[model samples]
Target: MITAYKKNDMTSFKIKVVGVGGAGGNIVQKIYLSGLGCETIILNTDSQAISRHRAHHLITIGKTVTRGGGAGADPDLGKKAAEESIHEILLKIQNADLLILVAGLGNGTGSGASPVIAKYAREKNILTVGVFTLPFEAEGKKDVAFKAIAEMEKYLNTMGIIDNNVISELVSMESSVKDAFDLVDRVVKNCVESIISIVQETSDVNVDFNDLKSLISRGGLGYFAKGIAEKPEDVDKAIESVVFNPLLTGVTISDVKGALINIKSNGELTMNHFREILDKIRAHLPEKAPIKYGLQKEGDHRVDSYAEIYLIGTTGKRTTDEVIDKITSKQTNWKNFEIPPGVRKHKK
Candidate 1:
């Protein structure tokens, strides 16, 4: 059985997992089903879509404009929907200790509403972290998604990203439709789960909610990786595998500003094993950066001497204007940059 610790009571931290669009809603649904003990809500322009999903709450935005139909892949309308219903959204998010915004950018609701809601949460002094999936080239939404991401960087405390193209190459290929989506949802669920578990799961080392708050509130990109190590020596290897994990698609840890490393094993885990894991992980990173780490060992008889190590950290590089300008460079005479159509249908 898993042993959960308590220093700052879990009840004191009010966490709301808000699903922004169809994709976001779907991800949040999986997280809710995992029973992580957070309030889950789905926000969408599609009334029909939200009605079909299961969550603690369902919020339909831009009811007057979209008539409860959908955003029609228009980011402008998605933004307007959130704007029109800003009051209700804020009310729902009020007093939240942390907000995890889940969505797949490139759709009207996800692309448009994500940035707006993030900015609103920041205005209220609530820490916000965005978990998102980029559109595939087949979906013809990358260019649009890029613009939305640039805007979101301004308000989000940290962005945890997964590229759909990478997911296609690594996970969804060769699988049936339902199975493929199950794989996709698992990635999203794992990303959200890893972070929440860091805060909610108690340990002897205690990487509590406040520690996570300090790590995320720096306003840059967030990196989270978790995997198992079969042997004591495999602890470092587990962390290395996470660096190239598909969920983080395109990030490098060479220049991380701040980092938190966590490792867990069965009851036989030792402090020496934990220290070596931290040392090995740091050896791969920049020399000067100090690392914060924690350890936990659950007394499960079925498990032996194995370790599950997670690396959670962020680099402060929120230069929204420069990044967008570099992305949409005026210096180059590039082609129309339009993605091809005939991709899968939209979902949160």
Candidate 2:
């Protein structure tokens, strides 16, 4: 079982899981088995699509819009189904503490419902995170996947959303379908674990839904980062020295004046070590920029020597102006880009 200390005395946290089709069904099943100890709810736009799969904790939502078909064949039906799914999900998760979205890329249900669900959840004060899979690059679904990703990113900028891409290089290395699914499951579980820890453990370093939302919305090209020792010998020591538990999500390099650092620990954190790391980062900071730092403790976890830094970059109007100038310089002639003849039209 997953063990975690509770910071609040609430009876139980409500977590809703919304899946799109077969891919989403698979992810929800794995999360159900992960045993995070929260009340679970599941929503699938296509009920018939996931009828073969069963979960005691899931609550399937909406009727099937299409049978024995792919998402690309019918855009209108896809949008309608997604709208119905979101409506069902909102009604079920009114008092939820968290909403976890799981689905595969290039689909109408997953892509369409995710943003709407997230918007409603945030308005209800629910912490939201999305674990979505991307389509394989050569599958001719790149445009579909890209549009979905861009939409999700825009929503996340304004709301709390943490995403894991299933089509990464590491995921591609898996030999079998089961192996790929397992790898993706592990990554999603780890991310969930970290979020749970932050919520349950009262630490000075706790990250709230708002903080996460702000970081992701502004941070461009976000990637995870973990701390590693400058040097290593044995594997165990290496693991201990390098803090694998630290998950730095999303990073942006724009208009960032400085950062406010907060540290939390059960034990004493060496001020010198903390300063050393900060100093190294500050060297790169713009001159005369303001930086704030603090330390506190309230969590159950002990911190002999641990620190996780989330680097965020900010951008301003100046950056946009510069980009426009750079792009215009290379444009000798301008023409409206259009789709080639006979390309598949978006289905109504």
Candidate 3:
């Protein structure tokens, strides 16, 4: 079970999670309902989509153009709507110190509005992070999704990309389509919650706002995975969950530029537990890559000892400007959906 932190406890910094479009809205709703310590907002071109979810704020963009209608899977139309209604969007996010923009790329609203909003937030000097998902191969929207991701990467301080194909692979064969999607939502929620806990919750070694800002803001992509252990014997299980997380497929562990790890136990954590976990992680990291962690005692007491580990890792040194050049150059072909090599894809 995820624990919620009170608003009053957020005295150190202000964080806001803005969900855009259908997939984005669902993810934000989960985070909000989980009781994480942050403000939540839902933005969509479709009024009905916004109505379906509850958030701290519900906004309808491009009112003059879209008039509460859906973007109809048109990226151009989606971008126009956000551009026209940016004033309203700005109002809701002006006070946020950290802005996390969640969206599902390849469709109209998410693919279009996400980049526009992220760019504007950065202009206000707000630290921005983007958590996005690509469409499955069968959707045939690879071009649309990659284009949006490239654009978003140019603006966001750091971003995590989860291929729908990879997510789908995690579900059992008998699971429904909805089950596969829910798993994606859960994975995203865990990431947002873990990052919040790292900075918001008090720990023996706290990872503060500055620590987070520094690590993610570095040029590259971000990766997140979490695991839980019920006893001393389960430490390896927990480490494997984090180090070899299936959600982070295609990652080159050696390319990791840096990482931030958070560990929580149910009041019975020992030094050996910490050492075993960190040592295993350190072995995979580049010698020069910086690593930071926060340790605390918190979790279920169903067993004598319980531990949860959360990791966020970064790879490569590709700056946002560099990525934009590669994405926008005329040599690039949208039809082919060409992106930097090494991003794995799956077929069903």
Candidate 4:
């Protein structure tokens, strides 16, 4: 195992991020290099693939099964590879207070190994959360993706999902495939950054690690979004961005069971800034739902002035079914009309 540390103790609440497979490895590398100060591990079946990443720890699984090759897009082989390397995987995550698993579900290692690792983490009494991306309809991996998601939910405390189909529809027609993927990566990175800021930064009205645990732990199907205001005058507009983010499509805020609102600014934060953001958030959530907020000061006022709103909301069983349906169901009326893989197009 390779290790890199910014702090000897990392943080009071240790967060470990483990990325499984190619897509996951790329995401973890971005997080590590971004200087989030979290312990990161990147695991792959292929030696060549694992060599490409620089992280806190790098691991190669299934030496016997794959012989340093790869899983060949087969999730079964991916699962077996992880099972073959369970001991090593368990060692990397044993000490973490919070374990965040990142993967793109559909094929091979990410779809296969992530759920297994999460199951192990949950058994160790770690608070596990998952951030995953769904394959587009054209990829023909919906069945595999949904199956992995079900397995993950069985073990994770909460999860944030990004549907590639939704993202594809939202991006400009002229944008390349790489550009679309970069946006997905940014969304996952923002989620991790939000968590880090809330627990690591000190505030007058603080939301500690325990507060976050109470709100998100075992609260299924969560939504996370980040919004920014260039100056104090635009704070309301930022709140609107947080609430109406396209990533949160099909989720109902009124049914939300728990909420966390973190505001980070380059300039001085005031009582009115907090009240305005909180009141707007409160209007959408149920009165009985518990809420926590954290304020953090960052950046330099001389160069730029901005307030970032990081909103995390979790829902109960009622919205969970609705949200899952929205992701797994087929939509035939899309304007672009990309066919699912292996389907023949009908003649006019």
Candidate 5:
């Protein structure tokens, strides 16, 4: 098992951002400028596409397409591009305490390569997290995006991933491409900041490999909530406080029946405390949902219960093996997910 460290004890973190032509490159550039203090590496297939936006730290991988840089016809080519890019990036990530991946899916490069990169990072025992963008419905790239999303969802169900709908939610908020880019830039910036905060602030709370695996496997954005309460009765109040606000409130897509609940504490995760927390959560969930709980003794912070509860959803029918097979079965053309023609001059 890989040894874990407290947040404060972590000395360095390395983040790699991969993109398929200009979109991925643009996002990586924004993240580099966000000033998170972590070592940053940018990986792309086309050197020419990212040449102007390249930073001293950015590293280009693979070859650019001489012709059309759009999504490829053959699926296998995408996987090949990703594998090669990841093989190169792995050398740079040797001792990184944390790995953050940024990319937009549906395109050949980012969609194809992300999973390979994620698998490699996990094998190295680095805590890997992905911040990915979904394609817009109107982009005529929906099928490509959907396939990529399905693959991503399948991979993420067993690994760490954070989904951001850039084209739909982020772009629609603004009128111009510049405005959309700025909005996405801000979102990516906030995400990087939050991650940095978690790494920098020392916490007695230890997130084990099992916990990380379980979290990335079964949890999604709606599964997370944060609040503090000292007593059993107060726990309900805490969850309620967050749920009352429409913006903070979220609903789970999965039934959550037969779901497992794991709780960790520096002290004891008492039966009484467990019941209190479980009951509070159940109050918001469906009455028939079956829940189970487990406890650990590592968290030791006083200002807060140092408590976090995660809910795992298992409604999807897709299996991990099927996803892997699909990814591996395809030929590695690597050229399909290239930058489109005439979209020159990468933007911030």
Candidate 6:
């Protein structure tokens, strides 16, 4: 068994993505399928849920309460189940250098247990990044959902929030809710993979794990922006698509304190191309905040003209509005819920 705190306790330099509950577990399976060069684990109250999932590592918790059945949307029961299995979770994450948590809030296990797990990991001083999905307005339990997020943000290095309503709107008109969610999982995976590439893969310019560590550890609500552009004219649109992506609750370049820019492009990427891209991105960001950049060159030479760029940054402080608001619309019926404290925004 991999022991905990094997590396430097504050940072592991290893990456682990843990998914809590059914929706969270489902997303974990998607990221696992991508083979992103990180350890992936799934935790759930349902034995059948774990059995069907494809992650190499799986933990079924709360078998006593639910008897391998589901949480039945009872968040209180979900939280209790996670407490019962905290020991196993601690052991599983003992050696992690960086932990990325995935889940869909508003449900029982994701909303209840995920925050508990994040708290334990943070107590160990592990760098924790959260990638979470909120339910559609139609779900009606925004109270439980946002509470879980606020609790987790107290310990997260950065958190990426994806609005399921946005996902629902962007997906094919004929798609099922499951299909829409699966598509949203792909968005989550892409954003997380972009971050993973920075730490795990070598870059021509070099933005190592240490840089990422410094950025997240300094304390702030995390923000991530990503876009792909091929034509020279599409620069603004590409960058806008990323920074102003609808998935983010209401975050912008203005929300973060520092920034890291990374480019994954073909060999055709030229100095002129990079400089223009950099200039354009910087033109919109605050003049005072520092920007760290790196480049990854791909061998594909089939007349490629597109580059995928990831801009990762977050503020040392996030306002209450940023936490509870959405980029596209207002929550007409969610007003009864109080804004949870210590909230961070994460978008995929």
Computed on alpha carbons, the lDDT of every model, listed in order, comes to: 0.73, 0.44, 0.74, 0.74, 0.47, 0.71
Better of 1 and 5 by lDDT: 1
> By lDDT, highest first, what's the ranking?
3, 4, 1, 6, 5, 2
Better of 1 and 6 by lDDT: 1
Tell me the spans in candidate 3 whose CA falls farther than 4 Å from its real position.
1-11, 249-252, 297-305, 319-348
lDDT per residue (tens digit) for residues 212-292 in model 3: 788778756666767777787888877776666444333434556887888888878778888888889888778887787
lDDT of 5 by residue, 187-280 (tens): 4444444344333333444333343344344433323223344544555554443222111112232333334444445364465765676666
Quote the positional error of residue 134 for candidate 3 in Å: 0.3
Local accuracy of candidate 4 as per-residue lDDT tens digits, 1-348: 111112223248888999999988999999999888789999999899899899999999988998879887788888999999999998999989888888888988989888889898989999888888888789898788878877777788888777777764456655666776777788788777766666665554456777678767845777676667778887877777666545433354565677777777775657688678778877877887777776554443432546778777777543445556855553212232222232313334
Q: Estimate the Cα RMSD of every predicted model relative to the unseen true structure.
A: 7.5, 11.5, 7.5, 7.7, 11.4, 8.5
Instruction: Show model 6 residue runs off by greater than 4 Å.
Output: 1-12, 168-179, 229-237, 297-306, 319-322, 325-348
Looking at model 2, report the run of 10 residues with the lowest lDDT sum. Answer: 331-340
Better of 1 and 4 by lDDT: 4
Comparing 2 and 6 on lDDT, the stronger one: 6
Model 2, residue pairs in steric clash: 157-217, 202-299, 222-250, 252-313, 254-314, 254-315, 255-314
Lowest-lDDT window of 10 residues in candidate 1? 330-339
- Two-way TM-score contest, 3 vs 6, winner: 3
Q: Which stretches of candidate 2 lie over 4 Å from their true place?
A: 1-17, 52-59, 67-76, 122-127, 157-174, 203-348
Clashes of 4: 0
What are the models' TM-scores?
Answer: 0.82, 0.56, 0.85, 0.85, 0.54, 0.82
